[model samples]
Target: MAKLLEIRWHGRAGQGAKTAALVLAEAAISAGRYAQAFPEYGPERMGAPMQAFNRISDEPITVHSHVTNPSIVVILDPTLIAATNVKAGVPADGIYLVNTTMGPCEMRKRLGLTDSPAKVYTLDATQISMDTIGRAMPNTPMMGALVGATGLLELDQLIADTREKLGRKLRPEIVEKNIEAIRRAFQEVAS
Candidate 1:
Protein backbone atom coordinates (compact mmCIF):
# COMPACT_ATOMS: atom_id res chain seq x y z
CA MET A 1 0.00 0.00 0.00
CA ALA A 2 1.14 3.54 -0.69
CA LYS A 3 1.91 5.61 2.38
CA LEU A 4 -0.36 8.61 2.83
CA LEU A 5 0.70 11.58 4.92
CA GLU A 6 -1.98 13.83 6.35
CA ILE A 7 -1.14 17.26 7.72
CA ARG A 8 -3.25 19.89 9.45
CA TRP A 9 -2.25 23.51 9.87
CA HIS A 10 -3.75 25.88 12.43
CA GLY A 11 -3.34 29.64 12.28
CA ARG A 12 -5.14 32.95 12.00
CA ALA A 13 -6.69 34.38 8.84
CA GLY A 14 -3.73 36.58 7.90
CA GLN A 15 -0.96 34.23 8.93
CA GLY A 16 -0.62 32.33 5.64
CA ALA A 17 -1.39 28.82 6.88
CA LYS A 18 -3.36 28.21 3.71
CA THR A 19 -0.53 29.55 1.60
CA ALA A 20 2.00 27.29 3.33
CA ALA A 21 -0.17 24.23 2.75
CA LEU A 22 -0.57 25.15 -0.91
CA VAL A 23 3.16 25.65 -1.28
CA LEU A 24 3.90 22.30 0.31
CA ALA A 25 1.43 20.58 -1.98
CA GLU A 26 2.96 22.31 -4.95
CA ALA A 27 6.45 21.33 -3.87
CA ALA A 28 5.38 17.75 -3.37
CA ILE A 29 3.84 17.69 -6.82
CA SER A 30 7.00 19.16 -8.25
CA ALA A 31 8.91 16.33 -6.63
CA GLY A 32 6.71 13.79 -8.48
CA ARG A 33 4.31 13.04 -5.64
CA TYR A 34 0.53 13.24 -5.45
CA ALA A 35 -0.77 15.92 -3.13
CA GLN A 36 -3.76 18.06 -2.21
CA ALA A 37 -4.08 21.32 -0.28
CA PHE A 38 -7.20 23.09 0.97
CA PRO A 39 -8.28 25.46 3.68
CA GLU A 40 -11.18 25.92 6.14
CA TYR A 41 -11.97 29.43 7.16
CA GLY A 42 -14.04 30.73 10.03
CA PRO A 43 -15.46 34.30 10.30
CA GLU A 44 -13.37 35.38 7.30
CA ARG A 45 -11.56 38.05 9.26
CA MET A 46 -7.93 38.75 9.95
CA GLY A 47 -6.73 37.07 13.15
CA ALA A 48 -9.71 34.70 13.08
CA PRO A 49 -8.76 31.08 13.61
CA MET A 50 -8.64 28.89 10.51
CA GLN A 51 -7.32 25.57 9.29
CA ALA A 52 -5.60 24.16 6.24
CA PHE A 53 -5.13 20.54 5.27
CA ASN A 54 -2.74 18.61 3.07
CA ARG A 55 -2.56 15.04 1.85
CA ILE A 56 0.56 13.77 0.15
CA SER A 57 1.16 10.26 -1.03
CA ASP A 58 3.24 8.26 -3.43
CA GLU A 59 0.06 7.29 -5.29
CA PRO A 60 -2.97 9.30 -6.28
CA ILE A 61 -5.28 10.47 -3.51
CA THR A 62 -9.03 9.83 -3.79
CA VAL A 63 -10.41 11.18 -0.55
CA HIS A 64 -11.16 14.90 -0.43
CA SER A 65 -12.07 15.88 3.10
CA HIS A 66 -10.82 17.51 6.23
CA VAL A 67 -8.05 15.66 8.00
CA THR A 68 -9.53 14.53 11.28
CA ASN A 69 -6.57 12.33 12.17
CA PRO A 70 -3.45 14.12 11.15
CA SER A 71 -0.09 12.46 11.35
CA ILE A 72 1.49 15.90 11.48
CA VAL A 73 0.12 19.17 12.82
CA VAL A 74 1.66 22.59 12.25
CA ILE A 75 0.70 25.45 14.50
CA LEU A 76 1.62 28.89 13.13
CA ASP A 77 0.26 30.93 15.98
CA PRO A 78 1.19 29.97 19.51
CA THR A 79 -1.88 31.72 20.91
CA LEU A 80 -4.10 29.24 19.13
CA ILE A 81 -2.56 26.48 21.24
CA ALA A 82 -4.64 27.66 24.16
CA ALA A 83 -7.60 28.87 22.14
CA THR A 84 -8.04 25.64 20.23
CA ASN A 85 -7.73 22.00 21.07
CA VAL A 86 -4.61 21.57 18.95
CA LYS A 87 -4.37 17.91 19.82
CA ALA A 88 -7.97 17.00 19.16
CA GLY A 89 -7.39 14.33 16.51
CA VAL A 90 -3.64 13.83 16.63
CA PRO A 91 -2.57 10.29 17.35
CA ALA A 92 -0.10 9.34 20.06
CA ASP A 93 2.66 9.01 17.50
CA GLY A 94 1.79 12.20 15.69
CA ILE A 95 4.35 14.97 15.29
CA TYR A 96 3.67 18.59 16.20
CA LEU A 97 5.66 21.48 14.72
CA VAL A 98 4.92 24.69 16.54
CA ASN A 99 6.05 28.29 15.97
CA THR A 100 7.17 29.69 19.29
CA THR A 101 10.22 30.77 21.19
CA MET A 102 9.81 27.81 23.49
CA GLY A 103 11.91 24.70 23.00
CA PRO A 104 10.39 21.29 22.52
CA CYS A 105 10.76 20.29 26.16
CA GLU A 106 9.09 23.48 27.35
CA MET A 107 6.38 23.06 24.78
CA ARG A 108 5.73 19.54 26.00
CA LYS A 109 5.42 20.79 29.55
CA ARG A 110 3.12 23.65 28.65
CA LEU A 111 0.89 21.47 26.49
CA GLY A 112 0.75 18.92 29.30
CA LEU A 113 1.99 16.21 26.99
CA THR A 114 5.37 15.51 28.52
CA ASP A 115 4.52 11.86 28.96
CA SER A 116 2.65 11.43 25.70
CA PRO A 117 3.99 9.46 22.79
CA ALA A 118 3.56 12.38 20.42
CA LYS A 119 6.79 14.12 19.47
CA VAL A 120 6.85 17.87 19.99
CA TYR A 121 9.14 20.13 18.01
CA THR A 122 9.36 23.89 18.09
CA LEU A 123 11.18 26.83 16.54
CA ASP A 124 11.11 30.55 17.00
CA ALA A 125 9.53 30.89 13.58
CA THR A 126 8.06 34.27 14.42
CA GLN A 127 11.48 35.62 15.23
CA ILE A 128 12.99 34.03 12.16
CA SER A 129 10.27 35.56 10.01
CA MET A 130 10.74 38.95 11.53
CA ASP A 131 14.49 38.77 11.04
CA THR A 132 14.39 37.43 7.51
CA ILE A 133 11.08 38.66 6.09
CA GLY A 134 10.83 41.74 8.28
CA ARG A 135 7.44 40.59 9.50
CA ALA A 136 6.03 38.33 12.18
CA MET A 137 4.19 36.14 9.70
CA PRO A 138 5.39 32.64 10.58
CA ASN A 139 3.65 30.61 7.88
CA THR A 140 6.68 30.27 5.63
CA PRO A 141 9.03 29.55 8.46
CA MET A 142 6.66 26.93 9.81
CA MET A 143 6.68 25.29 6.41
CA GLY A 144 10.40 24.81 6.76
CA ALA A 145 9.85 23.32 10.19
CA LEU A 146 7.23 21.01 8.71
CA VAL A 147 9.66 19.76 6.13
CA GLY A 148 12.32 19.32 8.77
CA ALA A 149 10.00 17.47 11.10
CA THR A 150 8.43 15.21 8.48
CA GLY A 151 11.00 14.96 5.63
CA LEU A 152 8.07 14.46 3.27
CA LEU A 153 9.68 16.66 0.63
CA GLU A 154 13.14 17.90 -0.16
CA LEU A 155 14.08 21.23 1.39
CA ASP A 156 15.70 22.49 -1.80
CA GLN A 157 12.58 21.66 -3.79
CA LEU A 158 10.39 23.57 -1.39
CA ILE A 159 12.59 26.64 -1.64
CA ALA A 160 12.64 26.54 -5.40
CA ASP A 161 8.88 26.09 -5.65
CA THR A 162 8.24 28.86 -3.17
CA ARG A 163 10.41 31.25 -5.12
CA GLU A 164 8.75 30.38 -8.40
CA LYS A 165 5.23 30.70 -7.03
CA LEU A 166 5.74 33.74 -4.85
CA GLY A 167 8.08 35.58 -7.18
CA ARG A 168 5.32 36.05 -9.70
CA LYS A 169 3.44 38.23 -7.21
CA LEU A 170 6.09 39.58 -4.88
CA ARG A 171 9.32 41.52 -5.25
CA PRO A 172 12.54 39.60 -5.64
CA GLU A 173 13.83 40.73 -2.24
CA ILE A 174 10.70 39.53 -0.45
CA VAL A 175 10.98 36.21 -2.17
CA GLU A 176 14.58 35.80 -1.12
CA LYS A 177 13.72 36.72 2.44
CA ASN A 178 10.95 34.16 2.53
CA ILE A 179 13.31 31.48 1.30
CA GLU A 180 15.84 32.45 3.91
CA ALA A 181 13.14 32.18 6.56
CA ILE A 182 12.38 28.66 5.39
CA ARG A 183 16.02 27.62 5.44
CA ARG A 184 16.55 29.04 8.91
CA ALA A 185 13.47 27.37 10.30
CA PHE A 186 14.41 24.05 8.79
CA GLN A 187 17.76 24.14 10.48
CA GLU A 188 16.63 25.67 13.76
CA VAL A 189 13.62 23.52 14.64
CA ALA A 190 14.34 21.61 17.86
CA SER A 191 12.87 18.40 19.21
Candidate 2:
Protein backbone atom coordinates (compact mmCIF):
# COMPACT_ATOMS: atom_id res chain seq x y z
CA MET A 1 0.00 0.00 0.00
CA ALA A 2 1.10 3.52 -0.69
CA LYS A 3 1.93 5.67 2.29
CA LEU A 4 -0.59 8.43 2.81
CA LEU A 5 0.88 11.77 3.77
CA GLU A 6 -0.65 12.98 7.02
CA ILE A 7 -0.27 16.53 8.25
CA ARG A 8 -1.27 17.94 11.59
CA TRP A 9 -1.69 21.67 12.17
CA HIS A 10 -1.70 23.34 15.59
CA GLY A 11 -2.83 26.88 16.33
CA ARG A 12 -5.38 29.00 18.11
CA ALA A 13 -8.94 29.19 16.98
CA GLY A 14 -8.65 32.54 15.22
CA GLN A 15 -5.56 31.56 13.30
CA GLY A 16 -5.98 29.97 9.86
CA ALA A 17 -5.05 26.36 10.59
CA LYS A 18 -8.34 25.01 9.38
CA THR A 19 -8.28 27.13 6.29
CA ALA A 20 -4.76 26.09 5.49
CA ALA A 21 -5.59 22.39 5.73
CA LEU A 22 -8.69 22.80 3.63
CA VAL A 23 -6.86 24.78 0.99
CA LEU A 24 -4.07 22.25 0.75
CA ALA A 25 -6.51 19.37 0.39
CA GLU A 26 -8.39 21.30 -2.28
CA ALA A 27 -5.23 21.98 -4.20
CA ALA A 28 -4.13 18.33 -3.95
CA ILE A 29 -7.50 17.16 -5.21
CA SER A 30 -7.22 19.57 -8.08
CA ALA A 31 -3.89 17.93 -8.87
CA GLY A 32 -5.66 14.54 -9.12
CA ARG A 33 -4.69 13.22 -5.67
CA TYR A 34 -7.10 11.97 -3.02
CA ALA A 35 -7.17 14.27 -0.01
CA GLN A 36 -9.06 15.06 3.16
CA ALA A 37 -9.03 18.07 5.47
CA PHE A 38 -10.87 18.45 8.76
CA PRO A 39 -10.71 20.47 11.93
CA GLU A 40 -10.93 19.56 15.61
CA TYR A 41 -12.17 22.41 17.74
CA GLY A 42 -12.46 22.68 21.47
CA PRO A 43 -14.63 25.31 23.19
CA GLU A 44 -16.28 27.76 20.84
CA ARG A 45 -14.09 30.80 21.34
CA MET A 46 -11.17 32.56 19.77
CA GLY A 47 -7.71 32.00 21.29
CA ALA A 48 -8.70 28.46 22.20
CA PRO A 49 -6.36 25.69 21.13
CA MET A 50 -7.40 23.90 17.97
CA GLN A 51 -6.17 21.43 15.42
CA ALA A 52 -6.67 20.67 11.77
CA PHE A 53 -5.60 17.64 9.80
CA ASN A 54 -4.93 16.58 6.25
CA ARG A 55 -4.41 13.24 4.56
CA ILE A 56 -3.26 13.01 0.98
CA SER A 57 -2.49 9.95 -1.07
CA ASP A 58 -2.39 8.62 -4.58
CA GLU A 59 -4.89 6.01 -3.48
CA PRO A 60 -7.99 6.62 -1.35
CA ILE A 61 -7.44 7.18 2.35
CA THR A 62 -8.95 4.63 4.77
CA VAL A 63 -7.93 5.81 8.20
CA HIS A 64 -10.46 8.16 9.80
CA SER A 65 -9.02 8.70 13.25
CA HIS A 66 -7.31 11.88 14.40
CA VAL A 67 -3.81 12.09 13.02
CA THR A 68 -1.69 10.65 15.83
CA ASN A 69 1.42 10.11 13.76
CA PRO A 70 1.56 12.90 11.25
CA SER A 71 4.53 12.88 8.93
CA ILE A 72 4.38 16.68 8.93
CA VAL A 73 3.43 18.83 11.90
CA VAL A 74 2.88 22.56 11.42
CA ILE A 75 2.81 24.94 14.35
CA LEU A 76 1.10 28.18 13.42
CA ASP A 77 2.10 29.80 16.72
CA PRO A 78 5.56 29.40 18.18
CA THR A 79 4.18 29.96 21.66
CA LEU A 80 2.49 26.62 21.40
CA ILE A 81 5.88 25.04 21.66
CA ALA A 82 6.13 26.07 25.31
CA ALA A 83 2.46 25.87 26.12
CA THR A 84 1.83 22.43 24.65
CA ASN A 85 3.65 19.30 23.63
CA VAL A 86 3.74 20.29 20.00
CA LYS A 87 5.99 17.33 19.36
CA ALA A 88 3.43 14.79 20.47
CA GLY A 89 2.79 11.86 18.16
CA VAL A 90 5.51 12.85 15.74
CA PRO A 91 7.94 10.27 14.42
CA ALA A 92 11.64 10.81 15.05
CA ASP A 93 12.13 11.93 11.47
CA GLY A 94 8.94 13.93 11.10
CA ILE A 95 9.02 17.49 9.82
CA TYR A 96 8.33 20.39 12.18
CA LEU A 97 7.33 23.53 10.33
CA VAL A 98 6.88 26.43 12.70
CA ASN A 99 5.93 30.08 12.35
CA THR A 100 8.48 32.12 14.24
CA THR A 101 11.35 34.55 13.96
CA MET A 102 13.83 31.97 15.21
CA GLY A 103 16.29 30.26 12.93
CA PRO A 104 15.92 26.56 12.23
CA CYS A 105 18.96 25.61 14.26
CA GLU A 106 17.83 27.68 17.24
CA MET A 107 14.31 26.31 16.93
CA ARG A 108 15.68 22.80 16.76
CA LYS A 109 17.48 23.42 20.04
CA ARG A 110 14.40 24.93 21.61
CA LEU A 111 12.35 21.94 20.55
CA GLY A 112 15.01 19.63 21.98
CA LEU A 113 15.57 18.30 18.49
CA THR A 114 19.31 19.02 18.43
CA ASP A 115 20.19 15.34 18.09
CA SER A 116 17.04 14.17 16.40
CA PRO A 117 16.72 13.37 12.74
CA ALA A 118 13.53 15.42 12.44
CA LYS A 119 13.84 18.43 10.13
CA VAL A 120 12.99 21.82 11.60
CA TYR A 121 11.79 24.76 9.54
CA THR A 122 10.89 28.25 10.67
CA LEU A 123 9.52 31.52 9.26
CA ASP A 124 8.06 34.69 10.63
CA ALA A 125 4.68 34.13 9.11
CA THR A 126 3.10 36.80 11.30
CA GLN A 127 5.51 39.37 9.96
CA ILE A 128 5.02 38.10 6.44
CA SER A 129 1.25 38.38 6.73
CA MET A 130 1.39 41.82 8.31
CA ASP A 131 3.71 43.04 5.62
CA THR A 132 1.60 41.62 2.81
CA ILE A 133 -1.97 41.70 4.11
CA GLY A 134 -1.84 44.42 6.76
CA ARG A 135 -2.95 41.77 9.27
CA ALA A 136 -1.28 39.27 11.56
CA MET A 137 -3.03 36.22 10.16
CA PRO A 138 -0.31 33.63 9.56
CA ASN A 139 -2.41 30.95 7.90
CA THR A 140 -1.74 31.74 4.25
CA PRO A 141 1.94 32.43 4.72
CA MET A 142 2.43 29.23 6.73
CA MET A 143 0.63 27.29 4.03
CA GLY A 144 2.95 28.83 1.49
CA ALA A 145 5.96 27.96 3.59
CA LEU A 146 4.70 24.40 3.93
CA VAL A 147 4.44 24.02 0.19
CA GLY A 148 7.81 25.62 -0.29
CA ALA A 149 9.38 23.23 2.18
CA THR A 150 7.64 19.99 1.23
CA GLY A 151 6.59 20.43 -2.39
CA LEU A 152 3.47 18.43 -1.52
CA LEU A 153 1.56 20.45 -4.07
CA GLU A 154 2.67 22.79 -6.80
CA LEU A 155 3.02 26.41 -5.69
CA ASP A 156 0.91 27.77 -8.52
CA GLN A 157 -1.85 25.29 -7.85
CA LEU A 158 -2.00 26.20 -4.16
CA ILE A 159 -2.10 29.91 -5.01
CA ALA A 160 -4.86 29.42 -7.55
CA ASP A 161 -6.93 27.44 -5.05
CA THR A 162 -6.32 30.01 -2.33
CA ARG A 163 -7.31 32.82 -4.66
CA GLU A 164 -10.48 31.06 -5.71
CA LYS A 165 -11.39 30.23 -2.11
CA LEU A 166 -10.77 33.66 -0.56
CA GLY A 167 -12.12 35.66 -3.47
CA ARG A 168 -15.65 34.72 -2.54
CA LYS A 169 -15.55 36.76 0.68
CA LEU A 170 -12.77 39.35 0.44
CA ARG A 171 -12.17 42.39 -1.71
CA PRO A 172 -10.00 42.06 -4.80
CA GLU A 173 -7.14 43.97 -3.19
CA ILE A 174 -7.33 41.96 0.02
CA VAL A 175 -7.26 38.70 -1.90
CA GLU A 176 -4.28 39.92 -3.87
CA LYS A 177 -2.51 40.79 -0.64
CA ASN A 178 -3.02 37.25 0.66
CA ILE A 179 -1.66 35.83 -2.58
CA GLU A 180 1.38 38.02 -2.13
CA ALA A 181 1.80 36.78 1.42
CA ILE A 182 1.72 33.18 0.21
CA ARG A 183 4.27 33.88 -2.50
CA ARG A 184 6.58 35.77 -0.17
CA ALA A 185 6.56 33.13 2.51
CA PHE A 186 7.27 30.47 -0.07
CA GLN A 187 10.56 32.21 -0.72
CA GLU A 188 11.33 33.19 2.87
CA VAL A 189 10.92 29.89 4.78
CA ALA A 190 14.14 28.70 6.45
CA SER A 191 14.77 25.02 6.87
Candidate 3:
Protein backbone atom coordinates (compact mmCIF):
# COMPACT_ATOMS: atom_id res chain seq x y z
CA MET A 1 0.00 0.00 0.00
CA ALA A 2 1.16 3.50 -0.67
CA LYS A 3 1.98 5.60 2.36
CA LEU A 4 -0.33 8.52 3.05
CA LEU A 5 0.50 11.67 4.97
CA GLU A 6 -1.82 14.51 5.84
CA ILE A 7 -0.84 17.94 7.09
CA ARG A 8 -3.04 20.53 8.75
CA TRP A 9 -2.07 24.15 9.10
CA HIS A 10 -3.38 26.55 11.75
CA GLY A 11 -2.70 30.24 11.56
CA ARG A 12 -4.12 33.70 11.25
CA ALA A 13 -5.26 34.98 7.87
CA GLY A 14 -2.16 36.96 6.89
CA GLN A 15 0.41 34.49 8.21
CA GLY A 16 0.89 32.55 4.97
CA ALA A 17 -0.49 29.24 6.31
CA LYS A 18 -2.44 28.60 3.12
CA THR A 19 0.54 29.48 1.00
CA ALA A 20 2.67 27.09 3.00
CA ALA A 21 0.31 24.21 2.28
CA LEU A 22 0.22 25.03 -1.42
CA VAL A 23 3.97 25.33 -1.67
CA LEU A 24 4.47 22.07 0.19
CA ALA A 25 2.03 20.28 -2.12
CA GLU A 26 3.81 21.69 -5.14
CA ALA A 27 7.13 20.57 -3.77
CA ALA A 28 5.83 17.09 -3.07
CA ILE A 29 4.36 16.85 -6.56
CA SER A 30 7.66 17.99 -8.03
CA ALA A 31 9.24 15.14 -6.11
CA GLY A 32 6.86 12.72 -7.89
CA ARG A 33 4.42 12.22 -5.01
CA TYR A 34 0.68 12.54 -5.35
CA ALA A 35 -0.33 15.68 -3.52
CA GLN A 36 -3.43 17.76 -2.85
CA ALA A 37 -3.49 21.19 -1.20
CA PHE A 38 -6.39 23.45 -0.26
CA PRO A 39 -7.45 25.92 2.38
CA GLU A 40 -10.54 26.22 4.59
CA TYR A 41 -11.32 29.88 4.90
CA GLY A 42 -13.81 31.14 7.40
CA PRO A 43 -14.37 34.86 7.99
CA GLU A 44 -12.11 36.67 5.56
CA ARG A 45 -10.56 38.79 8.23
CA MET A 46 -6.85 39.29 8.62
CA GLY A 47 -6.44 38.21 12.25
CA ALA A 48 -8.99 35.41 12.18
CA PRO A 49 -7.63 31.94 12.60
CA MET A 50 -7.81 29.76 9.46
CA GLN A 51 -6.75 26.37 8.28
CA ALA A 52 -5.28 24.62 5.25
CA PHE A 53 -4.91 20.94 4.45
CA ASN A 54 -2.67 18.74 2.38
CA ARG A 55 -2.66 15.04 1.54
CA ILE A 56 0.27 13.24 0.01
CA SER A 57 0.54 9.64 -1.01
CA ASP A 58 2.81 7.52 -3.07
CA GLU A 59 -0.26 6.51 -5.06
CA PRO A 60 -2.72 8.98 -6.55
CA ILE A 61 -5.06 10.61 -4.05
CA THR A 62 -8.74 10.07 -4.83
CA VAL A 63 -10.19 11.88 -1.85
CA HIS A 64 -10.34 15.61 -2.42
CA SER A 65 -11.45 16.44 1.08
CA HIS A 66 -10.37 18.27 4.17
CA VAL A 67 -8.06 16.52 6.54
CA THR A 68 -9.75 15.30 9.68
CA ASN A 69 -6.86 13.51 11.30
CA PRO A 70 -3.55 14.85 10.22
CA SER A 71 -0.21 13.17 10.63
CA ILE A 72 1.44 16.53 10.99
CA VAL A 73 0.10 19.86 12.26
CA VAL A 74 1.86 23.08 11.37
CA ILE A 75 1.02 26.22 13.30
CA LEU A 76 2.15 29.31 11.44
CA ASP A 77 0.90 31.77 14.00
CA PRO A 78 1.40 30.93 17.65
CA THR A 79 -1.29 33.36 18.64
CA LEU A 80 -3.91 31.16 16.99
CA ILE A 81 -3.69 28.85 19.95
CA ALA A 82 -5.84 31.35 21.81
CA ALA A 83 -8.61 31.23 19.19
CA THR A 84 -8.37 27.74 17.70
CA ASN A 85 -8.31 24.17 18.90
CA VAL A 86 -5.43 23.21 16.69
CA LYS A 87 -4.36 20.11 18.57
CA ALA A 88 -7.73 18.41 18.54
CA GLY A 89 -7.31 16.23 15.48
CA VAL A 90 -3.65 15.52 15.74
CA PRO A 91 -2.53 11.93 16.06
CA ALA A 92 -0.73 10.94 19.20
CA ASP A 93 2.34 9.71 17.37
CA GLY A 94 2.41 12.42 14.77
CA ILE A 95 4.52 15.55 14.70
CA TYR A 96 3.59 19.10 15.57
CA LEU A 97 5.51 21.98 14.06
CA VAL A 98 4.99 25.48 15.38
CA ASN A 99 6.53 28.85 14.59
CA THR A 100 7.36 30.52 17.87
CA THR A 101 10.10 31.84 20.06
CA MET A 102 9.03 29.44 22.80
CA GLY A 103 10.76 26.10 22.99
CA PRO A 104 9.03 22.75 22.88
CA CYS A 105 8.24 22.53 26.56
CA GLU A 106 6.76 26.00 26.68
CA MET A 107 4.72 25.36 23.57
CA ARG A 108 3.41 22.09 24.92
CA LYS A 109 2.43 23.86 28.11
CA ARG A 110 0.80 26.70 26.25
CA LEU A 111 -1.18 24.25 24.18
CA GLY A 112 -2.39 22.61 27.38
CA LEU A 113 -1.01 19.32 26.24
CA THR A 114 -0.33 16.91 29.08
CA ASP A 115 -1.31 13.35 28.26
CA SER A 116 -0.43 13.45 24.59
CA PRO A 117 2.89 12.06 23.46
CA ALA A 118 3.07 13.69 20.07
CA LYS A 119 6.46 15.01 19.13
CA VAL A 120 6.61 18.78 18.94
CA TYR A 121 9.17 21.04 17.33
CA THR A 122 9.20 24.79 17.66
CA LEU A 123 11.08 27.33 15.59
CA ASP A 124 11.37 31.04 15.35
CA ALA A 125 10.67 30.95 11.65
CA THR A 126 9.18 34.44 11.80
CA GLN A 127 12.44 35.88 12.97
CA ILE A 128 14.33 33.77 10.50
CA SER A 129 12.23 35.05 7.65
CA MET A 130 12.51 38.62 8.83
CA ASP A 131 16.27 38.39 9.11
CA THR A 132 16.87 36.46 5.91
CA ILE A 133 13.97 37.07 3.55
CA GLY A 134 13.39 40.63 4.86
CA ARG A 135 9.71 39.84 5.32
CA ALA A 136 7.44 37.94 7.68
CA MET A 137 6.46 35.52 4.92
CA PRO A 138 7.40 32.18 6.43
CA ASN A 139 5.70 29.75 4.09
CA THR A 140 8.85 28.60 2.31
CA PRO A 141 11.00 28.46 5.41
CA MET A 142 8.42 26.44 7.34
CA MET A 143 8.11 24.14 4.34
CA GLY A 144 11.84 23.59 4.58
CA ALA A 145 11.52 22.73 8.25
CA LEU A 146 8.72 20.27 7.44
CA VAL A 147 10.87 18.60 4.83
CA GLY A 148 13.66 18.20 7.33
CA ALA A 149 11.36 16.86 10.03
CA THR A 150 9.47 14.39 7.86
CA GLY A 151 12.22 13.42 5.44
CA LEU A 152 9.43 13.40 2.91
CA LEU A 153 11.62 14.95 0.23
CA GLU A 154 15.24 15.79 -0.35
CA LEU A 155 16.83 19.19 0.01
CA ASP A 156 17.59 19.40 -3.70
CA GLN A 157 13.99 18.63 -4.51
CA LEU A 158 12.74 21.46 -2.29
CA ILE A 159 15.26 23.91 -3.68
CA ALA A 160 14.39 22.98 -7.24
CA ASP A 161 10.67 23.14 -6.54
CA THR A 162 11.03 26.51 -4.84
CA ARG A 163 13.12 27.83 -7.69
CA GLU A 164 10.56 26.60 -10.17
CA LYS A 165 7.57 27.94 -8.25
CA LEU A 166 8.97 31.31 -7.13
CA GLY A 167 11.94 32.12 -9.33
CA ARG A 168 9.78 33.53 -12.11
CA LYS A 169 7.72 35.83 -9.96
CA LEU A 170 10.69 37.18 -8.01
CA ARG A 171 13.95 38.90 -8.89
CA PRO A 172 17.07 36.76 -8.87
CA GLU A 173 18.21 38.35 -5.63
CA ILE A 174 14.89 37.67 -3.95
CA VAL A 175 14.80 34.11 -5.21
CA GLU A 176 18.30 33.41 -3.93
CA LYS A 177 17.47 34.96 -0.60
CA ASN A 178 14.34 32.87 -0.19
CA ILE A 179 16.24 29.74 -1.11
CA GLU A 180 18.84 30.61 1.47
CA ALA A 181 16.11 31.13 4.06
CA ILE A 182 14.76 27.69 3.30
CA ARG A 183 18.16 26.15 3.75
CA ARG A 184 18.77 27.94 6.99
CA ALA A 185 15.41 26.94 8.39
CA PHE A 186 15.97 23.36 7.32
CA GLN A 187 19.24 23.28 9.17
CA GLU A 188 18.50 25.47 12.14
CA VAL A 189 14.80 25.06 12.91
CA ALA A 190 14.13 21.50 11.81
CA SER A 191 14.78 19.85 15.12
Angstrom error at residue 132, model 2: 0.5
Report the Cα RMSD per candidate: 1.2, 1.3, 1.8
| Candidate 1 stretches greater than 4 Å from native | none
- Tens digits of per-residue lDDT for model 2, 55-146: 99999887888888888999999888888888898999999999999999999999999999999999999999999999899999999999
Model 3 C-alpha lDDT per residue in residues 9-103, reported as the tens digit of each score: 98778877887788788888988889999999676898788899999899988997679999899988888888788877777777888889998
Residue pairs with colliding backbones in model 2 are none
Model 2: number of backbone collisions: 0
Weakest ten-residue segment in model 2 by summed lDDT: 1-10
**TM-score of model 1 (CA atoms):** 0.97
lDDT of each: 0.91, 0.92, 0.83
How many pairs of residues collide in each model?
Answer: 0, 0, 0
Backbone clashes in model 3, listed as residue pairs: none
